[model samples]
Target: MLTNAVPTTNGPVVGVEQGAVRAFKGVPFAIARRFAKPVAPAAWTEPRHCTDYGAYAPQPGHLDLAIEESCLSLNVWAPAADHPLPVLFFIHGGAFVTGGGADYDGSFLAAHGPAVIVTINYRLGPLGFLQLHRHGFGEANNLAMSDALAGLDWVRANIANFGGDPDAITLSGQSAGASMVIALATLPQARGKFIRALALSAPGRNIMSADHADDVARRVLEELDLAGDAGAITSVPLPTLFAAVERVSRRLADETEAGTLFGPVLDGTVIPHEPREVFADGSLCDIPLWLGSCRDEMAMFLKSMPPAAMIRTTERQVRAAFGEAGWERLLSCYRATARVDEDPYEALLSDAFWHRPMSDLARVHATAGGAVWLSRFDHRPALEPFLSQGPTHGADNACLWAHLPNFIDRPILKRMGGPMTPEDIDVAARFQANVLRFVTAGVPDIAEAWPRFEPAKEPLAIFSQPFHVIPLNDGARFRAWAELTARPGAVA
Candidate 1:
């Protein structure tokens, strides 16, 4: 069945109804040019049929979605309910380069959560993260972040029409999107927009310094042969512009500390200070958080590398960031914890990039009087090809969205661990329940079994076959990483 026309700030929209869930896709939230701030879309009187997804931001071809600048749209899935329901607004992750909200299907979560689910699309790659205002291109620093804010603003004003409580919204994301959630928490403009946050597999570092971002912009200009005339960027062909982005990314990967050219810039105005610092000082402690990463976050990347090469590359990087002595101590600590079939280097990269940073942030946030919950997805699915890699990156998403009809057919999940098993269903039910609990109740679990994260105890919910909560053993390995992070040039 199809849903009746629903009124929005911009206009009325008609959507599709699947069972008890009504899906409104391709709802334009805002509109923007190549390098300008997003503004609300023009008002329309006639009801628009939004049965299909809108175009996604331009990027290197990965998904088969249409690409265009007018990609600032969102999708909504509202379940049948008599009263208002909490909303889960999610941002998709692709390293700030590739991906769109349409990649995720919110039907399962909407019907099961009995909550309104909103997924959004934002600018990407050079179109999103390239800092060009300094070079007189336009007011383009953190434009994608601005786009996210605009989406939230639209939701705050229009969600109630669809039976969602405007006051209770949970901002959530995964990977690069998770980093944006953390960044949004520190922005004064985004302070009261969202009530809680859920960050999954957020990188240790995603913000780029102003100087580095400027350098990247310069390199991109040079690649496009527009270094002398930066204003010409507005007219460059899309394919040519993305090609330049790829070249600049490859050239600067080894030079930049964060190992990527595009990300949210530490612009003095938009993002005043480091997010971790803000969380450490208790300035944003009022908002609760639920954050975690998978056990083998780096396994997906390192699966193809020979063990010897993987160890050698990891050793060099670790030694450069941390001194030889620091590397030796870390090696000893990880060796003590490594499984018989596990590669210590893989574990080291995973912890350095994802696990340790999340753990540190949780500790600091808890120390600063914030209500927080820490978790780690440790269930390794029974699928093969890379089964020995254990619970790898994107595994959490696989379990979280397993109820979607096409979960087994999604290419990424298929590559990770797919063909959904009975065990996967069991894990997905548990994972989705915890998330829904937080969205509706503000706390994940009230029972003593899932106590709030505290710095003194460092408790973590381990999401495995038989889920359990235990105090994390922050032993020698953690200390070694902490010491390294304290050093001036350490990326973590």
Candidate 2:
């Protein structure tokens, strides 16, 4: 809903929040769309309307379902500030498969802290981070990383006229986006570009190896009866190429190069290291951290599962993935969270698969002396009924942006709001403010006493309609799980 434009040295700007300031769009910085590569855009004279978003690159098919590739684009929401505003650059996460920047309207987030909020589109799936045994055709990997890096370069070079503080930029992302942050954090060069980062709801272990990339390339070659070189891969249609990758994925086991679709490859180039591996080294030694997960992250994926069905699925999967001790540790967590002795399968999955990874990551942050603020995003009544998606992995974005129901109840949300409780709206506002604050000042304190990660006392600050600080770690439990994982048996 842009009303008018304001011209400047960089470009013409369109008003993002009618009552606030404006932002210009598509001001290119990097020369090529690929890695540290490509031709630069020619200089323009006329100020263009920054109202519209740029084209989103083709995205991979959704594993939960399939969607179109039309949602790629970047959006900025900047408000007038008495001083240069802090900038928040958000990287949208979609499992390296499906997602779009349009899903996040920066206005909701930017307005809260009076910051410049940016949401951008990046390449996805095989086009983003797939590797091959040998170079063939236009074969490449790490397109995802390239997209993010390019976007950052763009922000650094041009966000000035948009009222953004270049020196006060904070890179914020969730899930795959967070993974990108971890990768960038370890990059020797990407340092000094971003002042800080806030990685929300990112799973700790992702990324492939050089051999893994070669294996995937071999699989694609076998599927097409081609050679193991990159030169010939360009001949295949985009759909055919992606489908070939898919065939290997659905049929293979974990880390199996025999198959995989739309996931990042550890090609040892753009992504020099795995997230888990470099995280322990404290590469980004002093970057402030705010890490967390939802109370029912699995409930989102298991939206179709009732409590009982969730129990069955958790038992089956955990038993298969972790084995006996895994099962027991999960059982103990369930017993503690749900006093009725009923198996909270979703909760079990939440702690082991989601919560624990974040906790483990926090320990690394603490060791590095980085200020770490950890939390458990709690939805008082669970997040199943909204958006037909439960408190699924990426669901917390709703609260962070105050979209959907919360937006409806608030006057500022415009058409995005509906009917949400006041509590919902307030909590969302706090979360939004925290995101902006983190982006602007590298701190997420809602009010008095925004505490630090103190595993010795309260290990986490649980965020929800009624938020609180909680002590969730138990030495014995962690040790037991560690033993279970180390046994070479199972960890369910």
Which parts of model 1 have CA positions greater than 4 angstroms off?
Answer: 62-67, 304-317, 382-388, 404-419, 479-492
Provide the TM-score for each candidate, comma-separated: 0.92, 0.81
List, residue by residue over 89-129, the lDDT tens digit for candidate 2.
88877666656565666665666678888888776666566
TM-score of predicted structure 1: 0.92
lDDT of 2: 0.62
RMSD of each: 3.0, 5.2
**Candidate lDDT (C-alpha), each:** 0.82, 0.62
- Inter-residue clash pairs, candidate 1: none
Q: Report the lDDT tens digits of candidate 1 across residue range 1-492.
A: 679999999999999996789999989999988899999889998999988878877777733454465689999999989999999999888778877777777888989988999999999888888999889965889898999999999999999998899999999999889999999888889878888999999876757798888998999999998988999999888888888888777656555544567777899878888888889899878889999799888887776543313234445667887777777778787888788977787788888777877988898899999999999998886555326668887778767766632243343222432466666677767888899999999888776879888877778898887889877756666677777778888854
lDDT of 2 at 154: 66
